[model samples]
Target: MRQVLLINKDPDMHSDLNSLFQENNYESVILDEVETGNEALRKVVNDSYDMLILNLDLPNTNMLGLINKLRLLNQDLPILIYSLELEYIFIKRYLTSGVNGYCFFKNGDVGEILDAAVRISTGKWYISQEMVELIVEKALYSKKIDRFDNLDEQEFEILTHLIKGDTVANIAKIMGVHLPTVSVYKTRILDKLRITSLLELKNIIKIPLLSES
Candidate 1:
């Protein structure tokens, strides 16, 4: 039988997953339940588990750090991220961090959740359909931003200041340029970015900075 270490702070989630595993007739047992990342690390180090289902919101340790430590200890263990965070950036980061699968608790159905577990257990990656769509959308949005790469350094600087809620006059003062020069730069940036107004600029610029947070 395959053994799984389920790390989540919510007892109800643990119970639900246990029931789901049993109902699916998976010969897998949740061997341990841990509430925090530190406990998870200690358990995985001392005990044995074929798979790990991890919650991103662990209280006692950073999520990325815990995954890194677990990867160091057992490179072959299948790690599945069970998170409520719907941000594509977070999902992308976890996928890049050696996690074998991802399932959003709120958006994922039971079948997808089970499939994620089964697939990861067999050394395959699994991501929900919604997440795949989100990734694709982000990729397309990134391509749209690439069009503005032709902006000169000063124009790009001005764009950054504009995104940060800087007024045209304020940007001119900061860059030590006349207001008319800044206005011209702003017009050129808007044209290059293919945006018509400041609101559009704000919306377009948000995607590029999503991964930073």
Candidate 2:
């Protein structure tokens, strides 16, 4: 039997995952759940868990710092990032931090998660083929390029528009969408970077260079 500790806030999710794990014939893997980072710390420290599943959205948690601390605590423990964000750059950040594998949150994807956990526990790497290729490709580049890589097409467009001093209403008009849709995209962009305001990005981001006759 393998002990896999999952650190996430939602107990409902834990129940659903456990049920799925059992239904999918992963009975040998025990899914222990904890809510906070500290609780996860204590659980892993005291017990000999085979693997650790960390949620990126754990409330009030500095994820990278926690990963570093956990890595220092046990160099051999196979840690997996459990995240909902589909952004490759966001996943790469955590994967590079200290995690051995990742399980992106998708409805009814418990089998994939279990597979990743099982593989990593046995000292084998687990990730998508695209991610494997991407890792190799990205290794040659400076990490600064990945800062805004999480943005999708629309979000990037909105970001460029904002850089041009375009208001949300103006962007809505330009994009032929509702003001609320543009507003939501703006919020998602900020949330992705964990910034409350776009002003914070000015130092890190180059001014959008555009020239028109």
Candidate 3:
């Protein structure tokens, strides 16, 4: 039987995955709630597993930094993003960052989830049909680069939180960093995205790629 290190918090989802993996002759370890992102990093360092299925929407998660860190720490780990994120543009970065697969349980579709695990375990890549088109579309029509793309993982995290109305202090607490660190990230993200205000950030995320016309 194969094993997966699953970064998940939902018990029901875990239960569902357990049954599915058991039927398919696989098993998984449900990663416990991590107070700090460092704990998750440490777990990956100390443990051995066939796959890593990361849940990106987990609260207080630094989704980008974790990927960057994992790339440096365990370059060969086959990472699969089991995310609820619907935005293909946002997910496109992960696809390029050595993540082996991406899927969602939208409408409770477990088969795709299982398929993602199986494919990645065998050293293959997987991105759903729909997402492929979107990624390609943005790639083909490149003009001036999207400033949003220039923001690193930490900047992206801070930008998204601020766009969602999170205060700088709250974002600091969420990321387990000092208040001033988040402030610096905030300033840097705004500068990189070429936006001066939160209102612009919110609008930009909802629109198509910047300068793609």
Candidate 4:
């Protein structure tokens, strides 16, 4: 059985996660808080766990620094970050930080959390594809150039917006295209990528961009 450790400060979040993991037959160890980065590091060094679910905005300890320290200790252990902060730049930086996986607390679901855990337990990694689309699209817009050489201009735009957590209706308005058109673009993007879900998309983007943005 996979032994999973959840390091988060919120009670409701921990309860929800405990219920999910218990149903799935995984042993869930809950740490209500890490008083300091050193405390967290000690746990990591002492325990043998398959996955560590962390809140990036931990109190006092620099989040990225802690993650870096954890990486140094257990280079391949899974770190699943779920934060309430929803900034593209922050997420982008963390993705490039060599952590195992990530999800936003707002947009993330119980299924996503479980999915990431299961994947990581198998020595695999996860990233949200929408994240990839978001980063690449941001690059395209800011740089005023094509960041996705793999995609055509319109396809690139659609995929980028899609990954930004945009709904089809919103994407339609932004692209000046109909809802159906946006859906069609989504289908084509998925087909080209050979992926079926946004979860799969996350795994794809999270892994390749581990070292560099």
Score residue 172 of candidate 1 by CA lDDT. Answer: 79
lDDT of 3 by residue, 41-151 (tens): 887788766677787777666677778787788888888886665665567767777788888557777788888878877788988766777767767965656666777
Ranking by TM-score: 3, 1, 2, 4
lDDT of each: 0.73, 0.71, 0.72, 0.66
Question: What TM-score, over all chains together, does every model reach?
Answer: 0.65, 0.63, 0.83, 0.59
Runs with alpha carbons beyond 4 Å of true place in candidate 2: 129-213
lDDT of 4 at 14: 70
Residue 190 error for model 2, in Å? 13
For residues 53-109, what per-residue lDDT tens digits would candidate 4 score against the true structure? Answer: 887655433455567788999988788887665556456656767777777665547
- Looking at candidate 1, the ten consecutive residues that score lowest on lDDT are 204-213
The global Cα lDDT (0 to 1) of model 4 is 0.66
User: Least accurate stretch of 10 residues (summed lDDT) in model 4?
Assistant: 204-213
Query: Candidate 1 residues 20-84, lDDT tens each?
Result: 88888864565569887777889988999999988765543345657788999999999998766
**Which scores greater on TM-score, model 2 or model 3?**
3
Show the lowest summed lDDT stretch of 10 residues, model 2. 204-213
Cα shift from native, residue 81, model 2 (Å): 0.7
Which pairs of residues have clashing backbones in candidate 4? 126-203, 127-202, 127-203, 128-201, 128-202, 129-201, 129-202, 130-163
For residues 1-213, write the lDDT of model 2, one tens digit per residue. 378888988767778778877887877778899888788888878999888888876654546667877988889899988766455545665677678887766664667777787688788878855466666765664344454656765676576566556788887876668999999999998887667787875544532111221
